[model samples]
Target chain A: MRRIKCTVQYDGTWYAGYQVQPNSKTIQGEIEKVLEKIHGKPIRISASGRTDAGVHAIGQVFHFDTDTKFPVEKWLPIFNSQLPNDIVVNHVEEVAGSFHSRFGSIEKEYQYKVYRGPHKSPFLIHHAYHVPHSLSVQKMEEASRYLLGTHDFTSFCSAKTEVEDKVRTIFTISMEEEENMLTFSLVGNGFLYNMVRIIIGVLIEVGQGKRAPIEVKEILEAKDRRAGGKTAPAQGLYLYRVKYSNDN
Target chain B: MRRIKCTVQYDGTWYAGYQVQPNSKTIQGEIEKVLEKIHGKPIRISASGRTDAGVHAIGQVFHFDTDTKFPVEKWLPIFNSQLPNDIVVNHVEEVAGSFHSRFGSIEKEYQYKVYRGPHKSPFLIHHAYHVPHSLSVQKMEEASRYLLGTHDFTSFCSAKTEVEDKVRTIFTISMEEEENMLTFSLVGNGFLYNMVRIIIGVLIEVGQGKRAPIEVKEILEAKDRRAGGKTAPAQGLYLYRVKYSNDN
Candidate 1:
């Protein structure tokens, strides 16, 4: 009975999401199927968090307990061989038995990518959200100031979210612009369902001058989903990193 | 009748190649199908050159004469709406009737991208060729100098090539390295079949220290296909630009 943690990366273009579902392909389902073949039993694994369909990940974390005799280094190549080309397991290591991939997490970082140009590029169609209009990065940054610190993010959450509590602390929200591409990175303790995408929608409005920067504070205080802008598409969002207390 | 010239871009992952073929999906076939739907008759388009299967293009030029009453600006969005997501027509204009896309071309620029890293990224799987070893860019550039100017490129062409003349003038061969990614850009008046890819395979060997830089001169003089290295894969090669005698 040893627990092992793995850092995973996936394209997420062909997945139904991270969670397992009937009659659908998923990131976790693919991993479990490979593990089931190796362990010769039904093996359950837990991820740091769930991502929506069409989203991507860079350093998503997961943990599973196994009694197999394989070494730690062999897990990466083995899992990669069995997994589809879209999903890849990067690194594997032995972790403490009490470690939980989700509950033990301290913070996470996410990025929403946007390509602002007149013509859409075929190469970037799968990985980025194309905006045919120019964006003001300074305006987006000003609006982001209202999203820092602990607050009830009800306005930024999905309308059909099942969670009761909506309070979360956003450590930072930063935007980087290079030519026609803009990337928004958000670091937070935890995020509500579809929170990042909804926040990005609001920021895009500010960047486009449809909404003022100071209006973000009003939306946050309103505590209603309708107070915010429409949710951005899922393909632009990515789970960039998951931070834990031990840095393992 | 208007001679419409369009700059096209494609992912090329799902197509047979750039040219039309029997019972095969191709870039030209798709464009002609869209034109046929617009004109109620079959249309033939001539591209600057043909690209192999799985080869991407950023600035591929093509021209077709059409009697349709649509404006130049409307052709882009109209053709885009009818075409698949993997292919796009970027710029469309009415060119001179005598401006042929293939015969009127003076030069072409192509690039081969390489990712020199230990890990393969899912995001870059379709765009870059991954080499998990150190490469000497200086050595590759040194070997490229031997391939410059007018020469017979028979040694660097495919064995299955049916072209009679092998004489072509290579304007330049330059290498640019950014972090672990290396790009080799080549400019030439014309190219033999599979010439750029075969030349890249020889450069890769020079970078890997498998062959000396001066050996490229001997191979070029041999004028035999067996005198060169293997033909590199098609995915990493991109048709970057095409220059015509006139601005049209």
Candidate 2:
């Protein structure tokens, strides 16, 4: 048996999420169904993490073990042909048996898009979160600086998070605006559930002058979920990339 | 009565077409429904032209006569609020009563997008036509030169077209490649039913080396629908702009 790691890209608009759930369409359910057809048996796969519904992914990594005789090179085309259009298998490779998709990761990058056009664009309906009001990107950048570095991100994560250790190291947080679209890129060793969205919600409030840029520091010190602002909508979030130490 | 002209943009993936049919969801049907709701009576709109099913538009112009007291400045926000997310009323203006959206137009520009990515992109599934095969844009440009003048375009239109006059002047044809997307822009005095799509089909054939660049001359001289190649898919085509003489 050989363990295989594959990179996937998907538009999560129609998916219930990445995980398999009965009576609902999911990215994992569709992928495993295709894998079962290929291997003639049930096959389980492990993903880097779960994304909520309406969140997109450009490079989400997953690993699965299979004992089939199919050549590794042909896996890309074979999986793409059978899977739906929304999910694409970008690259495939053989990995060590002990390499875990979730645990062996070094860093992950995520992006959130916000459309600031006065009128909502039909082309961006499912791809971006529309904010008609004007925003100060400079103020947003100032607020984002306070979110960089290692800290307990309990205030920025969902209240339902079960993990006792809320500490995570955020290496970088950058913001760019082009053509009425604001994109926020965050790289970190790990992120708590809904952490990025909650951070974005607070930064947007800062940009709008509703909250001071210095308020971010106080929110992080509070270390409570109630200190954070509302969570941003799911559509604008994208799982941009996942990095592993082996560089595969 | 005031004649209100509006520039509309839409993603045509969910609509049957631009025309009003008995039992179909169309761009015109939706606009008319909103107009009726605002006016408390039936209202008909005249558009620059009709777009086939799955065809998109960026600057489709339409005009309707209304006796309502709503200020002209308020029409943009009012119409946008009532329309669905897939359709946006970009701009609204008060035009001369005699200025017809269809007849007063001096020029129209259309764009066709071809995605050259090896794997289908879920984000562009409804926005562009995916052509995985390698295409020579230089060869396509060579072929398009033969079509850049006033000529009898009977061979480049749909066989089901009802118009008797097939003569039209193509002012320009430009091709641009950025990233993995190739966009073809055409400016003409007018286009017959599916004329732009048929021309794109022939040009794509030239790009693929299936036909010589000079064959376009023969096809145009034939004046027969069977002489031209297939019609390109509607999704890649967009009515990018419509120009009028008065410039309202």
Candidate 3:
């Protein structure tokens, strides 16, 4: 058996989410069904992480085992031909048997995009949130800095979360503003349920001057959901990438 | 009666186009039907230009005369409450009687976005065309420069074009690239049918080293449909804005 790792990019607007659900269309489920047909056998895929409904993914990594003798180049075009236009296979490569996409993931990064302007862009309306109010980028950066270390982010997690250990190591937290768009990029070892969205909600409040930079630190220490702002909308967030070391 | 000019934004993925057509779910038809229900009178809107099927618009200006004296401040919220989530009324304001959305336009601008990257961006999948091959941005820019200024763009016009006058004034043609995304911003007094799309087709050829920049001038001079490259896909193009000096 050969372990095949593939990088996929998909517009999650129509998908229920990354994981398979009962009678629901999902990004991973669609791709896996197509892969099963191509391989002429049942192929289960392991993804780097799961994204909520209406979210997007850029460099999402997945791996599956196949007994077929087909080459890497053939898998992409063949698999993509069967999949819908919304989901696309970017690259496919053969890796060692030990290469498990989810288990091997080290750091994952996500970006929450917001467009601050009088008018929402027709072109990017679905991909970003339209914020009528102005945001202080400097203040947002200061608030983001409070989230740059390892902490139990229970307060910033969604109430629906089932994860018991909320202690996750955040490698970097950066906010960038270009013209009318402001983006928050967060890299962490792992994210709990709705963690990124909740963090973004607090950051947006900081940017809007509704919450001070000090509130971010207080929210993390509180370990209570009420300490943070409401969960930001899901469509504004995107699973950017998943990193893996060479040994893995 | 009051004439209100509204700046509209739409995803266009579900829309047939901007115009109302028989047996078609169009942007105009959708908005008009909603207005007719709200106003208790048939309402027709005049738009700056007709966007092709699946082509999105950010600042698409449209005007309609209403007998009911509805305040401009509540116009957007009220109209948006009726409009589908795919189509949104971003802003609305009262315009002078002489201000016609289609006829009073001084200049119009469009943006055609193309992305050349190893991985397709899931977030940008709907808005931009993903061309995996590496492209020469300088070449595309050089070819685009030939399109600036007054020109008889008959060759660039669609073969099925209905407009007799192919002569149009291209005021500015600026091409800029950031990272993997290449954007062409074209501002013109008026456009021939499929003019911007065909221009982008030729520009893409230049970027791919398939055609020379000097060939662009020859294509324009030919004044025949076969002279220019194929029309660019509609999904990659967006009607960015329609300009009227008073509104901005």
Model 2 error, position B69 (Å): 1.5
- Which candidate model has the greater TM-score, 1 or 3? 1
- In candidate 2, what are the lDDT values of residues A125-240, reduced to their tens digit? 88899998989999998988888889999999999989889999999999888889999999999899999999999999999999999999999999999999999999999999
How do all the candidates rank in terms of lDDT, highest first?
2, 1, 3
TM-score of each predicted structure versus truth: 0.97, 0.98, 0.90
Cα displacement (angstroms), candidate 1, residue B126, comes to 1.3
> What lDDT is obtained when candidate 2 is compared to the true structure?
0.94
Residue B68 of model 2, lDDT score: 91
What residue runs in model 1 are displaced by over 4 Å at the alpha carbon? none
Instruction: Give the true-contact fraction for every prediction, in order.
Output: 0.56, 0.89, 0.47
lDDT of 3 by residue, B47-103 (tens): 998988888887789999988866789788887778877788887888889999888
Candidate 2: residue A17 Cα off by (Å)? 1.0
The DockQ for candidate 3, computed on C-alphas, is 0.46
TM-score of 2: 0.98
| Candidate-wise lDDT, in order | 0.92, 0.94, 0.86
RMSD of 2: 1.2
Candidate 2 residue spans exceeding 4 A from truth = none
